[model samples]
Target: MTASLSWQKSTYSQEQGDCVELAVIGGAVLLRESDNPAVVLRTSRANLADFLQVIRQGPAKNSPPGR
Candidate 1:
């Protein structure tokens, strides 16, 4: 049987529509939004890490702190 994913919202999200969740199950990372849990995005943890790294090094750096 497939194991259920334990999804958690992003710390940066508020109680409204701007909610994102992530989980690691086996060899893949799962992503979803609180506004719609019926759909999911899956990818490798390495890929996710790389994407985050790029975001960190990109224009997101211009975002206000404490985000």
Candidate 2:
């Protein structure tokens, strides 16, 4: 969204509508919808790393989707 940061699409992003853009600014990571770039969200490195870890592991067999 800013003039300095370079945004790139997610590696896991396919040709489908599910896609996110990433940009690194200073010590923070910025994320936003590829379809709607105006709505941007920023997160700390630690939080982002944790989120990615969870996504990679995925949900347990007996657990719900959000678990």
Candidate 3:
């Protein structure tokens, strides 16, 4: 939202409006839904990394419909 960080859409973003955006600001991770970018969620980089590792090892985040 501010000029401090740049937000990028999730690589796994889908066409049906299921989009995730992320930014790194002030040594923390910021996340928002592309459909509604106003609401921001903050988390630690370490926590985000751990969750990503689990998701990467377990299941895909945005699997397309009927795949």
Candidate 4:
């Protein structure tokens, strides 16, 4: 059987201008905007998990905040 791909909004999304959508396909991860679905960024599952871990770890005081 083949795995299907679907997109879902991020739970971290708030009323602010920030929003994101994620898709899982063939053991990989894909991310895109809630408004613009045409553009997508692809990454490995491990890489995506690591990226999320870093984001969850929060930013340093001297570091520029992510958008």
**lDDT (tens digit, per residue) of candidate 4 on 1-67:** 1125567778878866658988887877888887776778989999988988998988877887673
Cα RMSD (Å) between model 2 and the true structure? 2.5
- Candidate 2, residues 1-67, lDDT tens digits: the string is 4656798888889978669989999899999887888889999999999999988997878996765
Q: Which stretches of candidate 3 lie over 4 Å from their true place?
A: 1-4, 14-16, 59-67
Enumerate residue pairs that collide in model 4: none
Writing each residue's lDDT as its tens digit, candidate 3 over 1-67 gives 5446698888777767668889988889899887787889999999998988987796556977654
What ranges in model 4 sit over 4 Å off?
1-4, 14-18, 61-67
**Which candidate leads the pack in TM-score?**
2
**Largest lDDT belongs to which candidate?**
2
Candidate number that wins on TM-score, 1 or 4? 1
**TM-score on alpha carbons, each prediction:** 0.73, 0.75, 0.67, 0.68
Q: Which digits, one per residue and each the tens of the lDDT, describe model 1 over residues 9-56? A: 898987775688998888998888787787889999999999999878
Between candidates 2 and 3, the one scoring higher on TM-score is 2
TM match of model 1 to true structure: 0.73
Query: Candidate 1's error at 24, in angstroms?
Result: 1.3
